[model samples]
Target: MAGLGGTKMKNTWQQVKKVGIVHRLLSFWSRDWFLKVVSIWLAIVLWVLVGGEDTIEKTVNVPVEIINLPRGLVVSNQYKKKIEVSLTGPRSVILDMDDRNIVRQVDLSKATPGTMVVNNDVDHIDVPRSLTVQRVQPPSIILSIDKLVQKQYAVVANTVGDVAPGFEVKSIRMNPEYVMITGPGSVLSQLSALQTSYISLDGFRRSEQLQVPLDLSPAIVSLIGETSVTADIVVGLVVAVKTVELPLVVQEKGLSLLPKTVSVTASFPQILLDKGKKAKDLLVAHAERYGQTDQFNVIVTSQNNEEFPVKVISVLPRRVSEGKAKLLRATTKKKSE
Candidate 1:
């Protein structure tokens, strides 16, 4: 029995030893160079799937030199003369660059009096290892400068308001219409003709007094600190007056009229009656001759009485040859009230 027990234990020990040997052989195969290389390649593929390349866009202000500036040309208000630029590329490259590495410039030497065209030559930007220039904000610019001759005109004051009803404007008066202005000879020659201050009252109702500021069209620097003309406008309302004419006619009611010539007469206020008295003054009038007549009456009506007081006065030629009398002349009375 003891011998059999020892045989059984030996067989178990042999099986355990075979298992250990198999494990050692598997470990050796796993540590092989070719297998180790394959595992590293798989790890790299997984890393690429999880992490991607970084791309970013950035904006920067690039400094530039203006070449070929024209003689006698001066640039005013050139504080922000740098060009605005935008760049896009790999994140690493863009983050490594600074604004000083970029260059911007405008050539004024070849410029003219008018708008000078700016060139879009942007080859001066020193980009980082991986970044490149994308675009510039203002591709070009026009440098406006003072020419030889320049002229300035005074600014006029325009009113806008409403006045009381039943009144009209009598007259409008302005203090000064023009001012003296001198600048570059070239600019002055172009501005040979000057315009007086123009007052515009598009929708004015009430009386108004305003001190308006003057503005120069196409603002020029030469007119700075120059003397400007001041103006005062007077607006008033007056009564409205109207003129009318009555024709000379003959009419009679209870008289057996005979054949005879008749005359006519008219009367009115000096201002109303005096207007167009002669052919030169008479804007329009009409009269017809008739025989002897009776029953004569002159009729008059008011046209516009809002401002001026108006009324009929007297008439001439009270009777005619026929039963009807001819209307000679009629008159109207006018007062300021």
Candidate 2:
């Protein structure tokens, strides 16, 4: 019985030993460092087989923006503003790039008043990767456009200087007072008024005609067209002459309570004087009675063939009694050439 027990015990011990050996071999192969190294090598071989160093070419459509345009002006040409890029690169890099990375620039400085077409050249794009441009979709674009117009504005007149001595300017008048302008709407909108040059009338004695130039504001002039306009101005002058008092002389058949003398007043040039005309020729008289006034118009004629350059003065009463006679004193004045 003891021998049999020993055999059983020994067999069990051998089985335990075999189990320990198997566990030791398994632990060696399952270590973290060994598995990590094997995985890295396997990934490298797979990448090599898939052409990791090789580049792939592809074309893409990238949208871009334009800048610096005049106010009210629109971009009417697409090809001039947009571009398509044909790029060849590693698939990973190319697929990761944003549209903005591949840019297109179009210059519009020389643009005119009509539709413009812009054709983008794929070669202009600068790609940092091992990539080559392949194609551009919609190679060109068209832009439509129009010109803008400005509005009319008012101009103020500035006057200077005085009229002749003893005379004054009563008023001034202008024809076609305002000026019209045409240009870009943005610039025209900023202008509120126009101004004329300084007008000097320093020593003028009689009525005169003047021509003044119209000056436009910078905002209005920038966008103007070929058409232009002129402004017409008219200045009026009023003069005051020297005046004197003259007495009236009444000598009619109807006589009643006659007055010793009556006076009249007149205005004329201070340089010229002639006094050889009768009262009827140079003076007029009138009378009022019972709230009714009588008026008369007198014509002055030289009776002595000597031109009495004098004009009729106003009567003292302006009117007298119908049946009374009255005498008037006369004053003379000289006239200008």
lDDT of 1: 0.49
TM-score of 2: 0.34
lDDT per residue for candidate 1 within 182-285, as digits (tens), equals 55444555553333334465444445454444444443434554334444444344422333334432233333222232222332223434443231132212
Q: What is the RMSD, in Å, between candidate 2 and the native fold over all Cα?
A: 18.5
Q: Global lDDT of each model?
A: 0.49, 0.53
lDDT at position 12, candidate 2 = 100
Backbone collision tally, model 1: 53
Candidate 2 local lDDT, 106-218, one digit each (tens): 55666656777766556655676466767776666665543566476775666777655534565554444666766545455666776566667677655665666655554
How much is 174 displaced in model 2, in angstroms? 2.8
The runs of at least 3 residues in candidate 1 whose Cα sits more than 4 Å from the true structure, single-residue gaps closed, are: 1-56, 61-84, 88-103, 124-134, 137-148, 157-208, 213-231, 236-337
Candidate 2 shows a clash count of 31
lDDT, candidate 2, residue 188? 58
